[model samples]
Target: MTERTVGLMVVAIMCVLILSRGMALAAPPLPPVPADYADKHMPDGWWTDPKVLAEGEKVYMGQVHPKVNCSNCHGKDGQPKKKGARDLRDPSLVNRFSDSFWFWRVKEGVPKTKMPAWKQYLNDEQMWAAIAFEHSFSHKGQAADHAHDEIQK
Candidate 1:
């Protein structure tokens, strides 16, 4: 009700805003894509290819190969279908991993996890295509957190 009270309230609000901004600035940046994990040569324009994307979509949907059914765990829209499955739609995580990382993980699979190695059932190209599909949900282009130089090579 008083001018002095209003001024004090404004100052408190300003202090909170300034502190939040500082905290955001103090946060560490996302790590770069690992050098060894970068792809040697990604299929040219494969990420943009309709047919390839279609195949990748099929792989995501578990249509092409029974073992390649990502949606069974990751959900159709990148949400986790089960309790431990990660929400793939999280850009903070998805954008941090390079194409090669995705490919390697798909090929080798994660240890002590539900994810199984898909290399035995699918060839390299199909795996790459599937990565493209997974990345499609949250790719941020060149400015994305992960380095995909190998994917373009």
Candidate 2:
């Protein structure tokens, strides 16, 4: 290819990369949990409890509620299966938010997004269980960050 053509291609690739990174970094900030949910938290040790995690996996896969399959969009392994679904495996996105924030999002769903309010089908324990399973994606072998258990007012 001509040098000019090659140079133009390089510039185009760089622009694409830069724009994508900017978009990733521009994710909306976590909205505040409503007063009722702000105080809700997972039961102690729920994050590491095998039984709880198992239950969470069921919830994630939609076994608990036929209408609530998170894997359809979030993927079985936390990678997004659909466009606009956030990658739950990314620690930068998942780990930074408190458990309360995650729980609130699951319960209420994000506005202007495909994520639907799961509260209609999921109770508190089921929602917390699903959040626990979701954390396993980004946290892997790490212990749960107990510090993020509650939302700060």
Candidate 3:
């Protein structure tokens, strides 16, 4: 190709990147981490605890007492609502990080992602329990798009 063509292509690519960066920058920044972040669970220990898993499901599935609502964003059957959220039914992330890291991230929330920290919503026990529940979703055999079942069922 001619040098001019190559230069134009480079400029076009750069413009796309710049536009994308500008779009991302336009969104408001996420909330800062809460002050009480220390002493949370380690990510490795999460999968092994049955109590935490049970409790996590109770909250994640709204089966627990007082019935907190995770079903609004993440689907009731453990699917995420929109594109960017993790599909809890998918397990490519299992054992990907320490169990406590999962707990902390869940408790602390991922900045720039829709995943909210359950810290304010749930206590520590409930937080770890939610982690266990999320891990359990990764072990499932659900169809790719759970929304199909929702409409039919």
Candidate 4:
């Protein structure tokens, strides 16, 4: 082959290799949270597990859970600690979302929001526990009054 033709062939090969590597490194897009997720049941009775709820309290309070520090922006009581934080205790807001919606949000985090994905740091069960604890805050007379003191005790 001619020298110029050989050089062009080498350049084409290099470009292909570079593009292939980039595609391999690219992460897959997160799945869209399903519309019918509200009707789905919790895995293995997560809603009724008192132990799971207790463990979730630790995670929410930044105690022994050892993953994301939820209370930094969410406050000990699930109330927002900052200007843009979601008020966890708002019944109207809490009532708007489903359990599956909460689970997906906690796992994936919201775009353009302060929430970060906890999927890397927390396991599925821990995530559910945290959700239960957050849900607890919206119930009347069930606020996390002593959540701040949980770790200390």
Model-by-model lDDT, in order?
0.72, 0.84, 0.61, 0.72
Q: What's the count of clashing pairs in each model shown? A: 0, 0, 11, 0
Q: TM-score, each model? A: 0.65, 0.76, 0.54, 0.63
RMSD of each: 6.9, 5.8, 9.7, 14.5
Cα-based lDDT at residue 65, candidate 3: 39
Native-to-model Cα distance after best TM-score fit, residue 4 in candidate 1, in Å: 32
Off by over 4 Å in 4: 1-32, 35-40, 65-67, 141-153
Which residue pairs come into collision in candidate 4? none
Which whole-number lDDT from 0 to 100 does residue 115 have in model 3? 73
**Model 3: which ten-residue window has the lowest total lDDT?**
144-153
Can you tell me which runs of candidate 1 are displaced by over 4 Å? 1-41, 139-153
Residue 132, model 3: lDDT of 66
**Candidate number of the best TM-score:** 2
Minimal lDDT window, size 10, model 2: 144-153
Q: What is the lDDT of residue 35 in candidate 4?
A: 65
Full-model lDDT, candidate 4 = 0.72
Q: What lDDT does candidate 3 reach at residue 55? A: 69
